[model samples]
Structures are given as structure tokens and as C-alpha cells.
Target chain A: MNYTDVFGEPTRGKYVIAGINVGMILRKDWTTHQQARDYLCDFDGEPQIVEGIDDEFIREKHKEYPHLSLADCEYMWTGAHFCEELLKFDGFMLHASAVVYKERAYLFSAPSGTGKSTHTKQWLDAFGEDAYILNDDKPVIRLLNGKAVVFGTPWSGKTDQNRNAGVLLGGICFLERADENWIKPVGAKDAAFGILNQTIRPGDKKRLVKLLELLDNVIKTTGVFRMGCTISTDAAIMSYDAMKGETRA
Target chain B: MKVKSDFVLKEVAGQWIVAPSGDASISFNAMITLNDSGAFLWKTLEGGASEEELVSALLGEYEVSEETARAGVRNFVEKIREANLLDD
Candidate 1:
């Protein structure tokens, strides 16, 4: 079957994420998820096509899930497809809450319900206008000209915090709950595991390889830390100072 | 016994990491890292080497005695077995 037979006539929408112009083509009248709508860019200039989900693949995924609606299936397929496609351009999705501070991006990653979002909120409270959430979840990170950059994606989680922007990645921190706020540097080997635990491991061999390569580059360039902290402004301040190489008082 | 076909060994940033690929990766949650000698053994086992062959390869590659090589192979094989990366 041809592409048209599976996805019908394609309706194209252009979006720029992580410095890549993606032309997303979907079935006619089927809108993308709400979170991605804000990133819609003018359909000009050369763009990469994000392959539409085929009926057979959708059916197979639905059979495995057995509970998701057709729309949910489309959303999941789009996200997965986008991630795989982005890998070709040296990009991958990171499951973390990213915030912008001092014109740089800081990512806080943890398991679900691990207070990643709450910790970023503390940054906002402490820094006021100096800090803001770039993406609450699933931001796209890319390696460009030997620098790792972070970009806001449309797949931000429940908080719906995202901006159509990019920043040079400053640091990545793994979060753990604790009574007192503390942050410490971690080695590359330990940081690799921490990043892998939060990354979405791809089922495709080529994509997984590319993802690992990109992650290795990120580890080499970015400062990685493990922060144990309470949900207080002090946690944000302490982590901020630690990331900036300040000695703990 | 042999290394499972789905496991792919990759060298990233001068470190060796083993991860599952294709459908197996969907449920394979753990990624294993190996040192230089461990990586050599892994490659040797992928060719379906037996315990004796592994020990022989270790001895040839490193300046170790046969007894030490045998003991090292035994420990390495046991570790991979616990990780479920071997098909016995």
C-alpha cells in the first residue's frame, strides 16, 4: 500500500525544534497534539518529512495496548517517529525538566513523580525573572558544531511548560529526594548510567546507537551532578551554586 | 554457549557498552559496560567459544598463566550468565 492509502492525503505543518525545520505530514483534518501546536512555524524553506503512522503499525500498537484511543495511538506514533527521525540529525529526546538560567539550559532528570518539576519550580521562585522552565518534559537535545544544545519540544508533560527556543546546555543533574539540600559532582561513568536511566531507549538498533553516541558526547561536554534536596528555594540556590563551581558554605 | 544475537556491543567515548537491539530492547532495561579484557572475552564468546577456548584466548592476549586465565574465564562467564546475556 502507498503512503496515501494508509495516512490519506497529507496535511503538512512546519515546525522548528532544535534548529531543525520539520515538516510534519498527517492525515487530513487530524491535528497534532495540543502541546505541539504552539511550535507551528511558517511552511517555508527546506524541511524534513516526519513519516506518518501506517494503519498496520497503528493496529499492531493498539493490539498491544488495547486501551488507547485512535488519537492516543497517533500521538504515541508521532512522538516515537519524531524521536527516531531526529536521531538522524544528531538529536534525541531527554526525559527531563529543562530550565533557562543565565542564558543557558539546565536539565533536571529523575523517575516519574521524583519532583523534577517541583525542583524547577523552586528555581523559578528563587531566581524570579532570571529563571524559567524551557520544557517541563521531553526536551530535544542536539549536538551542533561540537556543542550540546537544548530545545523545547511540544511533548512537555502535564505542566505544559515549553518554549520554541534553544539554548546551550549548561549542566545536567539527577535529582533525589532528601531532607536537606545538597549537590555533588559525579563521574562520567556514573553520569552515563544516570542519563541512560532517564532516556527513552529506542527499539531500533541504528537509532539506539545514534542515541548512545549523542549521549556520550553530552557527557563529555556537560557537567553532571547528583542533587539530593528538599522542595525548598534553598535546594535551587544550592544546586545552582554547585553547578557553577562554587564551594559549599 | 554464545552471546545472544540481539545484544550489540558499542564503543562510545572510549568505553564499551552492551545494549539490546530491535524488539529485545523494548524489554531489556539494563546496559552492561566492560573493560578492555572483558570486551575481548565478550567478542570471543560471540564466536561460540567454550570455557577452554576463552582461557586460551585470555592467555594469548595477556601475559598470564594458564591457571589464572582459567579462573578469570570462569568468573567472567558466570557474571555474563547472571546477566542473562549468554545462550547456554
Candidate 2:
């Protein structure tokens, strides 16, 4: 039997991201009115402040939401709002889409519409069910003992797949699609820039320095790459193979 | 002096982020993180102050020459403006 039943409940699935323990609890009720009853979840003293939901409301809200929900949380929970709290609690949210391939997490991050979801789907189609998708939207990145670890939260893009969490960043991809498929390794400075851009934070001189420092530490331990590819499965496989080589390009 | 100015800012999500019209973005990646000096400069010039006002404030606060202060502030302001972080 699966140790975890559903998201948002006490189970083996509960784990810590950074120093913050993201505990989940799930509730299911058939009544449409019953769904409307809002529940409150707290992160330390800060409340999730979730409004009640009924089945229709949930379905409707789901349709209107910009992001996906693995469980039944609101899509408004962004990395910027939570990462600082998570960081203060010793955790941080990663600003990227994540998928688990061969039990390893691969992240695609860059500016919006840089094919993060498209790349994730490409990998999924290429690998079939052999690969699992964690988050196609906002995935959390936490540092464990100074090593970068990626977590799959319930939050995702339009895809409703609520896969469980995974640890260890197999590789990070900063996408820049071209006419041809190619995977290039990036150096610390470029990698730092790419990763820092994908991090959930504010922009200014001081923050830039801090982001630079954060990305520097993250890229030093976790390898970084620039994936220039097409929408082909071959390109997806090429990226996977490239990352497996484990050498900076 | 008719010195010109622009928006004030900080870094969020690894990009040069800023605040416009005195309101900041709600997302973490959208929030601008500023250092003490940058924050100070940002707030001072945030009221849409002119270049002269900005330079004068910097001169008074940081013990820097007018040319140096103007040049440095201009460069900083230029970077943020290029990123479109300014309000108006």
C-alpha cells in the first residue's frame, strides 16, 4: 500500500524543504455547498487564509487559475510570497518547472514562455510514464547541507498531475531554443545569472548581489546548462544525455 | 537645476526589479531587494525627483563629489530604466 494516501495529510510524504516542513492535508466531500467552506492553514503564524470552496467553485476556480494545484490550494500562493518565509524558516521556493526522470529531478528555468512546460511535456512524451512530473509551474528549491535540492509541490501549471516530492537536483537547464537541438554547458557566471533570474526575489543592486551570491553557491554544487533545442523528443533525450555526461560545456 | 530622474528599485528573481507609483509587485521573484545605499537613493528619488535633487541628496548623505555622485547615480538610474523598472 502507498504510505501516502493523498496530499495534505500526515503521511510518509511529508518532508522538509530547506528547513521548512511542508505538511499537507487533504479533504474530500461531495456536496457542492460543503466545498464552499473555507479552511485555514498556517505557516508558523502566517495563515494560508484560504476561502471556502465547493465542487463547482473548485472546478470553476481551477479553470480560472493561472497555475495548477496538486492538492486543493489556491493558485495565488506564489514563490515570492512564500520563499522569504520559507527562507526565514530555512527554505526557499524555486522559480522553475521540475520533472523527475529516472528518479532524478531535471529543472527547466528561464523567462516566461521559454518552453519550460513544453520541454517538460517533451521529456514526458519521450520517456512515457517512465518519467514523472512534479511541478510544471513553481517548484521549490531548498539547500540541504549546502547541496541544492528540488522539491515538487502541489502547485503546477495547467497540468493537474500531483506527483510526490523528490530531492537532489540532477541538473538545471537554462533554455534558449534555436532552429537546431543543442545542449551547451554554462560557466559559473552565466549559470549564476540564469539561475538567479529564475529565483523568486526582487530586483535592485543589493538584491542583485545577494541573488548573484545565491546562484553562485547553487551552481557551484549543481551543474548548469543552456539547452537550445526544438520541440522534438530527440531533443529531449539529447538534453537528458547531455546532463548525464556531467561536465560543463 | 533641472536634473532628471526615474524609478527606484531592488533585485528580485535575479533581475533588476523596481517599484513604480509607490507600489511593489506581490510575487517574491517580482519583489525588488535593495541594499542600504540603493534603497536610500531609491526612496529619495522615488518622488520623481530631478537629477539635481538626487545629486544634492547624495552629496549631503554620502560625502561624494557632485560629478561623481551624478555620474554614479545616473549610471544606476540608467540600468533600472533600461530594464523598464521605472514608474513614469
Candidate 3:
């Protein structure tokens, strides 16, 4: 018997994020068309938000996202706390658009409005079904059995475009808008700074240490690049070729 | 000078990066990258060394001359100081 049995609703739920079962209480009913709707299930556990932020924090968030409903604010809070707790499981969220091409997941990270989604769309247009978005925003990279695998989660930012999928992370590219499409492999230190700019910065020593160790493993194991790209499909082909060793055929 | 308290130096793929750890990050929002000699100096700073100690450590480790090592240490220490990452 679960909370759905006693409460007659999905008040208690769990999601399989990055291969971890995360159970948390559903504070309110979300409207239809939520991506989270794809993964909600009845679960029995004490899986509330891990050291969840206080209501005052959510209230402050309301000012930041005043256009959203209270339920959305709760969702945002839950996602944040979830990423922080993810450190314990050897995973952390990279603020990137994850795309799977040839069974490998490539993540493109940039500041908001820098066209991570737009670049992915171009890949979709150029490659068609050969490439698909795993998550348009917020993909989890977890070191599993010595491999850095990227997982799509339910709480993707803005657009509700995500698949409950996990694939080996092919590479990570920090994107920048440029007149011409050019991509180059950056050294690990420069890539690390770019990485820090995109993800949630842990405030405690424990989580910070964990996050850095995970990054050390990931940096050694993955290809890191700085891509200066345009909005054309040529940009897509160029980046894909550079990162995956695949050229448009 | 010592490595600042509540900050950490991590090596990722042979490159060293220093950033604030724990609560130190709240105020400082930057990560300083270090070259090989700079990383060695940072490791020496962990034990709270003077500039001369840092120069000697570099001389003992690298094939570079004392002048070259001093210039490298000064360059690195200046950068961290500008970033406010050193404990003096």
C-alpha cells in the first residue's frame, strides 16, 4: 500500500533519475503537460526533499519566477535539492542540452539564451532521427562503474523536453555564438571553469569535495571542448564531426 | 603565505584549478587556474611557506634556474593575490 492508496492521489511519488530512485511528496497537483507526468509512480519511503529549502526560500523564488504557480516553485525547489543530494550518488547536473547521436550522448552547455537548444534543433533538422534530444536542459552526468554516463531527468528547465534515458557521455562542449562555426578541444582547466559556471555550486565542504572529485574523474574520462558556432545546420555537422568523429554523409 | 582557508586545489586531467570550497564560495565566485609550476607552489603554500621557500621548492623540483623559478612563482602568486585566493 502506498500514499496513493491512503490519500487517493499521487501525493507520494518517486522518479527514476540517473538510475536512482528518488521518492518525494507531491505538494500539489501539477497541471497537465508536465514532463514529470511521464515518470511519476507510487512509492513507499521517507524520500522527501533532502534538507529541503524553507518556505521563505520558495517565497523568494516566487519573486524570481512570479509568473509561475506555487506548484512550479515547489518543483524548482525540489529539483535544486535533488541536484545537491545527487552528490552522494556520484552524479551532478550539468546545465546543458544533451543530445544522443549514434548511441552516444553529447552535452552542449552555455549560458541561458546562448542557443544550446537551437543548436540541438539544427542537429535534429540535419541528422533527422539519427540524433535526438535526451534533455534540452539539465542533464545528469553520473560516474557509473567507471564510466561517465549522462542521464535525462524529469525536471528539465523551461521546455519539458526530456526522456528517461541514460547513455555514455560522448563529450561536453561549451558553446559560444560566433560568426563562423568552429570547435576546438580546450584544456581541462579552462573546461573546468566553464563547467563550474553552468552547474549548481555546492556551498558545503562535503558536497563541494564530492563534486570536484566527480569532476576530476569526468574530466579525465571525457572530451571537453569550446565550440564557437553559428545557427546554421553546417554548425551542427561541424560540431558533431569534431566531437563524435562523424561527418555528415 | 598559505593557501587560503576553505579553498581547494584540484587537478583535472593534469591541469590544476583552485576555487573556494565550503562557505568560501559564497563571496568569491571565480576559479583560478594554475600551470604546473603554479600548482607546485600552491602545494607548497598548503604548508604555509614564504616566497623564498616557494622559490627553493620550485628549484628543487624543476630543471629551471632560480631566476626562472622566481619569475614563475611571482607570476602565479600575483595572479592568486589579484583573485584574492592567497592567505598572507
Error of 3 at B48 (Å): 2.7
Native contacts recovered, each model? 0.38, 0.00, 0.67
Model 1 C-alpha lDDT per residue in residues A102-143, reported as the tens digit of each score: 988889999999999999999999999989899998888899
Tell me the deviation in Å of residue B80 in model 2.
Answer: 9.2
Per TM-score, the best of the predicted structures is 1
Query: Judged by DockQ cut-offs, is candidate 1 incorrect, acceptable, medium or high?
Result: acceptable
- TM-score result, candidate 2: 0.55
- Give the alpha carbon lDDT tens digit for every residue of B1-88 in model 1: 7998778777765678888766666553456888888899999988899898899899999999898888889888887888888988
Q: How far off is residue A13 in model 2, in Å? A: 14
Best by DockQ: 3
What tens-digit string does per-residue lDDT give for candidate 3 at B1-88? Answer: 9878777777766778787775666653557778777888888899898889999999999999999999988988888888888777
- Clashes per model (N, Cα, C within 3 A): 0, 31, 0
Q: Model 1: how far is A173 from its true place, Å?
A: 1.3
Q: iRMS values in order, in angstroms? A: 2.1, 8.1, 1.9
lDDT (tens digit, per residue) of candidate 3 on A1-249: 123222123444566667777665554455312556666655566544332334565567888889976557767777888888888889999999999989889899999999999999998999998889999999999999988889988778888889888999888999999998899998777778888878987876567777888988888877889999999999999988888842111
| CA deviation > 4 Å runs, candidate 3 | A1-10, A31-33, A41-57, A63-68, A245-249, B22-29, B56-72
In terms of lDDT, model 2 sits at 0.57
Tell me, what's the RMSD of every candidate? 3.7, 8.8, 4.4
